[model samples]
Target chain A: MNAHHLRRGALFLWTALLLAFIFAPIVSTIIFSFNADRFPSLPWAGFSVRWYEAVFADATILRGLINSLIVAGATAIVASFLGFAAAYVDYRYRFLGKVVYTALIALPPAVPVVILGIAMLTFEGRLGLSGTLTGVAVGHIVLAVPFAMALVRMRLADLDPDIERAAWNLGATPWAAVSGVVIPFCLPAILASIFLTAAVSFDEFMIAWFVSGVNETLPVRVLAMLQGQVSPKINAIGAIVFVVSMSLVVIAQVLIGNRADRSSKRT
Target chain B: MAFWAIPPILWQFAFFVVPLGFLVAMTFWSVRSFRLTPDMTLANWMFILKAGFFRSAYIYTFKLALLTALIASLSAFPAAYTLAFRLQPRTRRFLIFMLVVPFFTSYPVRIYSTQIFFSPEGIINAMIAPLGLGPVSVLDTPTGTVVGYLVLTLPLVLLLQTFALMNTPRDLIEAAHNLGCGRFRTILTVIVPTARVGLVLAATFAFVLSFGDYVAPLYLGGSNPPTLSILIADQVKSGNNWPRASVVAVTMILTLIVVMTAMLALAYGGRKKGRG
Candidate 1:
């Protein structure tokens, strides 16, 4: 083979290995979810949905999943709204402390989630709000806000300010110019941020572990279950989470990619 | 106009900043048999510094973070390079999509899966066992923790590096190639140097994620010396030593800032060198 062919073969092999390494554990768990036995091991006695059925019947897991949804939902809404506003301000005004605001916006995710979780734990305790769903929501907001802000900021940075100014110059109110023009333009990015933040909040564990007092999210429950030997029920939950999360991410990517393509074409 | 910015700022201050300030303040306060006191002392800091266990945890955790960051960045380089240059656009997009799938899943679930993969009778051992390799105890070892960290952060590095590589001007690479540079030479001298900033940023992020990670070590690391995150959690949860935990938290935050700043500086320096 020529050198170019050798390079191509090597690249293909490397990519396959990388994908295998990334997906193997995930695929294994998915397979285990259908195993007849409880533990994750070889000799799949037979494919069974008993674990799925068991997961459905488990009240605690069900409750945890519901709680996770509620928390993630609330987190997404609050984070997107707040983050959108911050991004707007940062985009529109080159104010003093703008850099500070940007830094703070990027700070949470950069910090260890565990530290943030611990900080929230102690912080909530001072406010007499320890171990509440609201407390967990607050933590999720801190985690999700930065992401939302970053996403919206990227979208806003790409926006032509002249369009909004032109709208306002044509007798449109400032709010009308923003809502009727800018927001409509940025809708895909906003939607992407919402789904991305929701996925993030839903999958969050350490923060939930710390802030979730009496309330347990699905991840925390999974952690508890894992302390025992690997249960097939956990695998069932994993399969559902994996499928749902992957679907949402794919949808978000498509939306973002479409937005990018449109914007690039316009430019 | 001011209302939108003010409320969120105030909200973050009231909820996030104030609470964190209280936590930090509490760290300096005395802890008597699990109950906190208002008395101020440097005892927490002193205790953390003096304690051999805490010192070891700090060193070991930093070491693990560094190792994981190095491994993640090196492995991701070729993948990122190929995606940026070699792959067709359609295939690149699909690969990138697949790369981020792990991120969307719940953090605990991923760690749990890692545990399954590493466990004595888990899929990994089961596969190897048939080849007469016997069982390899991947779970609870430093190697297992490293593997878990690698799996978690590799995609991130790949994404960031790919973004950086894609953003590089194509003409620059073509110019180098036209000057009689070999393909690998073009990539090394022209592409990697330009991509160094993003690689550093990605590595820094990987480092921070691995360093601060508590859940992975908690679930997958068995009997091994705990990472600093685990140590901090143990202090808060089991030891109930809030002050000590605070000290650890402070150390971690400071270390993160220092590492991040250093990485950014290195990236900036590299950019200047490339320009020169």
Candidate 2:
């Protein structure tokens, strides 16, 4: 019994250490962002938000932030719409090429971002869409739609087909049944997908780097800044980016979590 | 259904499929005066296939990816086991949430921050300074890259493994214990086999992500030995060699197809019906 207790203690310690290792880098970045030190080192400099101020002062960084917001916002709305449509199709009908359709929808993310980036750069260059924010948004939508589909599909799996059918049998039009029943049922997932995909586009670097030439997204901007020099200002940018993405993700999780809890309770 | 499905299908075909197809076709085209021109030639393929640097980079990337996957799987198993079997559901759920939060954060920022722990005069070295260990260089090394890869993959692998382990029926484990199997023995002879698919998938995911990654290897490893993704970027940015970049991208896609197919086969192969 004593040996078993010791073993359990060791395992707990190991898990704790693992979590620490996972979080250390991000935590350090956040901590250092508030430090007034030029270099992140032993002697803690006085607390300051100068780096954050510098991030705001920089015109290029500001442009990158705006561009990222626009791309993420556009990508979120369109990807969610298309993702809902695709997911609803999967839920509502069975077709001859269903497997193939699913595979194709899921294929974009499996392809490496580098390959996808170059491919987008090549194809969009032809359409005169490369080097534009719209092009980056399009690329992000391709990457994010799969996730949106997956999320909405999960929620749909819990939905009884009979519920929608009963609505239709009660003289409701297909469109009305969809808008009144399916849409409301999937509202949480749709909203979650919006925030999640927006976060995805916000943090995505490689595709944006390839497609957004002059209109660099925040992540792409950060990469350029990192390659150029080691600046404490990066910590500020990192912290802000981290906060924005984290907030979006947390809101998404809460949205999904509430539905999950309610569903589990019902079952 | 057709109305809902056809639009996404068309969109994916136009944006995803056509672009990939165009990439393959472009590989056969040549670059003239820094401009991609319409021409059918194998010169790009020939050059890339024959280049010593390409061969070395390919081998290096493959080896690195394999190492990352192996290490990530092995390390994640213990933590996953604890989460699955030891922790209460509420605690486990919270821990899983912690693991997942990293995915939404900026990956580049994470890789960049890893430099703080690995760089000379960085956190680790500074912490060990009083022990006379002084500064040890880890940044700009393969080790740094591995650490970055772990940052990217470990949380994901742990989550996958935990979910897989959680789904293992409790009765089977209890039956093994009743049969006088030791904890380690039960894990080896029963739990491992039961969760084999998920475990393999977790490793495969680690491989896929690391293999195609550019930022971690570049930012953390300093591109001392350029990975394929790095090569593609260099080809594009420096030489405007879209054809050569296309060649590399095609090779990568082909490699991924082969790897994914083989992994899926391995995960499902020879399993009894209904076992998975």
Candidate 3:
């Protein structure tokens, strides 16, 4: 008993140390974003929110945020639509070459971001879509689709097949069956995936580097700032972006969990 | 069913397959006065093959990947093991959530944070200066880049290995203990062996992530030999040489395939040895 107690204490201590190592950078960044000093460093310099004011006042940064919104919004819509369609097909009907479809959909996230970025840029250039916000959207769609598909498939696979079949037997057409039964069944997962894809597209930088032309996304703008100087302003903007996206992810998870609970009760 | 697969197939083929094929083909083509000409030649491939700079960059990238994988897996083991075996389920879930939270920060932002932390006039230097210790230069060096890589990869390693360790059977460890094995011996012979496949998969993921990253090396790897990813990015962003960039991309892709195969073999091998 004593040995077990000693072992548990050591494990807890080690875990605490590792957790601290992981949080150090993030906690420092969030703290120093309010640093009164010009440089983002320690010594407990007096706190100020002046850097947040700077971020809000910057027009170029705001434009980049708008550009990011456009790309991420389009990505969320297109990726979720295509991903749900693919996942629905795989789940509802048995078919040949389904595994190939699964592999093709999941493979993009595995490919190197730089390679994917350049490839899309070249391909978009071929279609005369290069150097436009639309081109960036094109890359974002590809980048985000895999995640959307995986999420949709997971949700779709969990649904009871009898509900959809019952709808079909009640004189509903295939499309009608899906609209009535399947769409409602997978709505929460679809919504969650849309938000998740938006977060991913918003965070992406490499694809934006290669595919985007005149307009910079928020991350690209941050990269440009990084080239000249390291200031409290970078920390401020980074903290805001991090907080906003993390909240989106957490909120999406909460919403999805609630829907899942209600559905389980109904079932 | 066929109809369902068609749209996604067409979508992916148009956006992904065609572009990848185009990229590979471009490697064999030549450029004339900034224009891509479909003149098939081995000139670009030959150039990358012969360039000592590219050769060293490839080796250096592999080195970083290996080192990152080793460091992350070693450090992650205790944390993952603790979470899988020692903690209550609720506490374990909360800790896992906390580990994943940092990843929500943008990739470039996370890498950029390290820049401020390790600068010559930054926090580390300041702390050491007060102690009368000489200033340590970590920013822009390989060490800095490694630290950035660990910041991202370590948590991932922890999560992956925890899943693997949780899947391990508790009975095996108990059986070893019953067989008169000491605590350390049981852990060595039973627990570590059983966790090998999961551990290898976790390491493989870390290796691949660190290997292909361009943003980290571009921002954190100052004055270091440009990684293959940086070389690939430079070829297009600055050099306007798509074909040359494709050559590097092709090499990187091939390396990825080779590394994946090697890791999968190790996973299978580890499982067999553990069973034996």
Candidate 4:
């Protein structure tokens, strides 16, 4: 083959191998969840849903799932609202110390989860919010808000500032202009941020592990189970969490992707 | 506009800034009979710093984080280059989406499942046995820890690299080629220089994440040689040593701030031309 063919073939092979490496753990988790084997190994012991059934039957796991859902939902709403407000403020105004404000908003995700977790744990302990689901939700909201703000901010960057001004000039109040014009323009990003933040909160482990004492989220529960024993049931829990998290992320991606397409077409 | 900004700013101050302040303050406080009493003593910091294990863990964590960043940046480049330059737009987009998917998934699950590939009786050994490469032990070792870090970072590094490389000006590459530069030389002199900021930022991100990651080291490395995160968890779990844990956490935060500032300077500073 020519050098051109060789280069193309090498690139394709590299892509395939990289993808295999990326997905191996996730694929193995899903496969073992369905495998009837007590341990994760090769030579499949036939397919069975018994582990999944075990997951559903467990009281603690069920409670953890419910707790995760609640935390994720609450975190999504609160974080998205705050994130939208933050993004809108950035979009509509230029104030002194804007750089500090932007940097502070972007700082949480960059910090190690261990540090954030302990800080939350210590501070919440003083506030009497420690060991409560509300504490866990609060921690998650802090972590997820930056992500939500980033998404909304990107969308806001595409919006013309004059549209809100036009709405105000047409006798609409500032609040009305925001609700009628700005929010509608940012609706897709807001929805995407909601899902993305929900996924983030749902998959988060360290903060939940620190603050959700006796009210463990699914990921925290998974860790407890993992430390306790190498159970096949953990594989089942992993599969479920993977599905839920991926679904939320996928929904968010689809929304953002669709918005990008529309905006690209407009340009 | 300032009115809309107040709530989020207040929320960040109340939760993020205030909690971090508490962490820093707690490092100076002493724990008495499982109760934390506020004091302005540096005992917690001194105790941890004097402990040999803590010092070793810091060195080990720094080395491992650097190793992860290096390996992830190097290995991800080929795939990232392929995606950015070799693929059709639709295929590239699909691959990019696939990379993004893992970031939002359950990281604990991902780290746990990696055990299957690292164990002596695991898939990696099984695959290599046919080639007469005897079953090698990787699980619970530094090698395994690095693998776990890679699993966390490689995809992210690849995505960032791809985005950065995609932004490389096409005309610059063509101009290099027309000047009789070889393909590799073109990449080195043209593409690499142009995408230096994004590339450096991507590797810095890899370093930052690997430095702070808790799951990979704990699960895959078995916490044998504890990282700072593992040490923090141990301190917190053992007899309510929250003060000691805060000391470690604060050390970590300081390390991150220093490293991030240095990396950002490397990425954006030192150049008269505004590239980034």
lDDT of 1 by residue, A1-267 (tens): 598898888887886787787777688778888989867776777999999999999999999999999998899889888888888888887878878876766567777888888889887887777788889998888878888887888888888899889998999998898899878877887888888888888888888988897799988888788778657788899998888777767777778899889889988
TM-score-better candidate, 1 vs 4: 4
Clashes of each: 1, 0, 0, 0
Cα deviation of A162 in candidate 3 (Å)?
2.5
lDDT of the structure predicted as candidate 3: 0.84
Off by over 4 Å in 1: A1-4, A264-267, B129-134
Quantify how close model 4 is to the true structure by its C-alpha RMSD in Å: 1.7
Tens-digit per-residue lDDT, B1-276, candidate 1 = 785577567656776677667768877899777588887899889988999988888898899999999998888888788899888999998888777887886666667777877677777887888799968886778888888888788878889999999988899999998899998898888888887888889999899999998776777776288888888888888888887898888889889889988998998875665678
Per-residue lDDT of B137-213 in model 3, one digit per residue for the tens? 87778887788778878888999899888988988877888888987787677777778788899999899888888
Give one digit per residue, the lDDT tens place, for model 2 in A85-123: 999999999888899998898789888899999999999
What DockQ was computed for model 1? 0.63
Please name the candidate that would achieve the greatest DockQ relative to the true structure: 2
Candidate 4's residue-wise lDDT over B1-276, tens digit each?
A: 767888888888899999999899888999887788989998888999999998999999999999999999888888888999998999998889889878876788888788867777778888899999969887788888899999999888999999999999888888888899988888787787778888898899898898988888888888878899999988887758988888888888889889888988888786666543
In candidate 1, which residue pairs clash?
Answer: B140-B222
- Of models 1 and 3, which has the larger DockQ? 3
Off by over 4 Å in 4: A1-4, B273-276
Error of 4 at B221 (Å): 0.7
Which lDDT tens digits does candidate 3 get at residues A139-206? 88887888888888888877889988888889899888888888888888899888888888888888
How much lDDT does each candidate structure score?
0.83, 0.91, 0.84, 0.89
Give the fraction of reference interface contacts each candidate recovers. Answer: 0.57, 0.74, 0.66, 0.78
TM-score of chain A of each: 0.93, 0.96, 0.93, 0.96
Which residue pairs clash within candidate 4?
none
